[model samples]
Target: MFLLSFPSLIPLLRAGLDLDCAESWIEEKGRPLRDFLSEYSKAAVEQGKLRESDIDNALRNQYMTLMRLGYFDNIPRYASLNETDICTDEHRSLAHDGARQGIVLLKNDGNLLPLDPEKILAVAVHGPHARAPEKVMDGDYTGPPCRYVTPRQGISKHVKISHRANTTIYLGGINLHIEREGNDREDLLLPKNQTEEILHFAKASQNPIILVILSGGGIDVSFAHKHPKIGAILWAGYPGGEGGNAIADVIFGRYNPGGRLPLTWFKNKYIQQIPMTSMEFRPVPEKGYPGRTYKFYDGPEVLYPFGYGLSYTKFHYETSTDGTSVTLPATGGHCKGLSYKPSVATTPSCQAVDVAGHACTETVSFNISVINGGGRGGAHVVLVYTAPPPEVAQAPIKQVAAFRRVFVPATSTATVPFTLNVCKAFGIVERTAYTVVPSGVSKVLVENGDSSSSVSFPVKIDFSV
Candidate 1:
């Protein structure tokens, strides 16, 4: 972090950057953190950049931080950390779990998954990215792993590293180049038409296709999602070292997928009008800036909405609500710890509720039951999305208020409880002051994999009248 203290890197550091974007991408042998700190001082003095006292202060703070982190302590926690501490069962399990749960089941058309090993016989896997996870990338910031689980280790020699389950399993995705940091990506789709390549194979093979995607962000998969030949699709993301095992477990029905997409996979045409440079948070219809995220973005319906995913087994939800609507009285005197700048408008008004203060207490709550509709007993995630107050000009179309995951048996129900604060959940940001949870009706929609149910919530402010 000594590099962060450099006057030249101040702008970048302020933008939440680390040493990665700093001028020193590498330090050939003798140049360690302290050496770099000294070098920065020399440059500052010679170039008349930073004052001597300022340089000294920065150096002092960095050194103090290192010391506090135990650099000079009698017993540093990392003093003897060796290779043995690297890949333990705990570490491997964490990696495996992350990859497993992060794997989003993008599509499982016609109930083509939870592959019936007894009937399907074998999975004919073939894809550009069907090899071991380490081969794609291992320890992106560090060295190689102690070991990695591969298809050869998991399956037999004949059942090689290829994608196309259901007899045809096609695995394809991106690498460290998710248009990541330093360099940028020009195209939304992969370097090659990996979809076309899969389609070609799908036509040649007799069986249906199962496409596994590995990438940091979503690309245009409208073709595959709608294709009659491609029956199942899974997005593994950058699953890490234990990714192979996780993929296998999902494919073979050993593990049930309850993971959801981390982002809204908008189609490629989205950028045609919506420039990447557009940083405007809200949509301006007069200006034609479409806005962004599942929160805003009006037209050009996304290929998959944020938090969209499927489970091996289907689910239906039933909610326990307080009838049609319930009114909440906002009469709690002066909301204890709340503070905000008064609205610049002459007629300024706001609900005196601090986000932190309300976050600690439950203002409203409801219960939801998740029932597994499919024959297979598996886990399901019940997503609760709340429609924001339409009165607010710059409000989201909908916001994910709460979510709960439950392991329900086949054809059985599991009740999931959700709590939310009306002021925090349905409130709108009008300028810098008033956080108006405008008194009116806001809708709360709960969804399982297949269907959704809505709950009406009408809030009334006791003090407003």
Candidate 2:
């Protein structure tokens, strides 16, 4: 029953023979085996366990598999593949594009962003990440990049080209630490010295100040968030090889930012209340669990919401639904109430069939029109969220079902259409079965940047199984 060598045993298994044999046995029994296998296959077909053509088909497939493996081994040499040249113009341009899209404008008060290069008399770049190309290039994979552009270098190049400022200052902060496996920071606050250094530069600068943050994750920035002197704040998250050029592009109005926050930027104090390991989706006051994620957390500890981001150009959203409701057959068992628990021994099933024995499905579709209200052109990411009916069992406050990124010209509009399965979004998990009792109303919200519009439709669970 044991397979000492897989390849040697494959033929025996395919021929429907189960036996344990040694390598020496194979030498004695397998060499002149064409006549033996042919007779054995003929016997197997008469016994009805296998078709007469099965043996030939299996042997042909096995031969083809071996040939494919041999062919794949020479592909690298045949194609002349080489390591990526991170320093090439093409690579750097791609890096610039990536950095531009990754940069998020968290706070831009008084229309201070997209700095006018002509009006500025002086510029100051102050941060640990200002000139550290090595730190910025240390990405998650492939170690450090071969070449990189520092924030200082990027700013200098653009400033020189525009002749925008008479002077520039570099006020350094804490050096960035490359995060490796099993090494995570204890807190989200900037180093004490770094904070002090930033404050010192902000107070000493005579002209408008720009604070550019460079790190991989969110940090507490309540002070900078409210600071009046800090004209602009850009979150340049570990810009790779061409980060410097991309930062300069955004600073000098060459590129309008369209990136949104991928994670919530929580205040430092909230970390104490919500441990990273908490798995509860809803807050448990009795157990002191604050819950997790943007779907359930209701506290004011968040500095920025999940989808919050800023842009140089403004956008407006006009959303409308088809005003139609769908009814799907209700199958599977339902919990009596929120506190009801099903027995562990019970087998759960989710087959949707009506009394007439017909499978049922429902689809929901909507449209969102995004208008570039600002004079500048930029890309907008339209987010669509669905709020389940209040009567739905154990539903999140809202869930993002669909999103689309679109480029709209200055003073132009782009219409985006989305089709989604309503059952997938609104279904409730009871025991192990995912079921939908489509009753009451569900709300759909279309959002982009700070604008949002919503529509609601009622669902009827008329058919039962």
Worst 10 residues of 1 by lDDT: 339-348
Q: What is the TM-score of candidate 2? A: 0.72
TM-score of each: 0.80, 0.72
Question: How many backbone overlaps does candidate 2 show?
Answer: 0
**Residue runs of model 2 more than 4 Å from their true location after superposition:** 1-72, 76-79, 84-89, 142-146, 161-181, 331-361, 427-439, 451-464
lDDT tens digits by residue: candidate 1, 1-465: 533456754343334332332334345565544344456656766786645666555657668778898888768567778778988889888877777787789888777876766666666767778764564634235456556775334433234444444377777877764545434556567557687788897787776788888777788888888888888889887677777787877887878898887688888887775667777766867878788888888876778888888887777776657434434334444232222324422221443343333432435677887777778888776777877444444666787877777899988888888777766666555444455454435677765553343344444332221
Model 1 alpha-carbon drift over 4 Å, by segment: 1-44, 47-49, 74-78, 132-146, 151-166, 323-362, 431-436, 450-465
Query: How much lDDT does candidate 1 score?
Result: 0.66
Give the per-residue lDDT digits (tens) of candidate 2, residues 296-363.
Answer: 67677588777777888888877665456765655453322221224323222422222222343567
Poorest stretch of ten by lDDT in candidate 2:
335-344
RMSD of 1: 5.6
| Residue pairs whose backbone atoms clash in candidate 2 | none
Please tell me which predicted candidate would have the highest lDDT against the true structure.
1
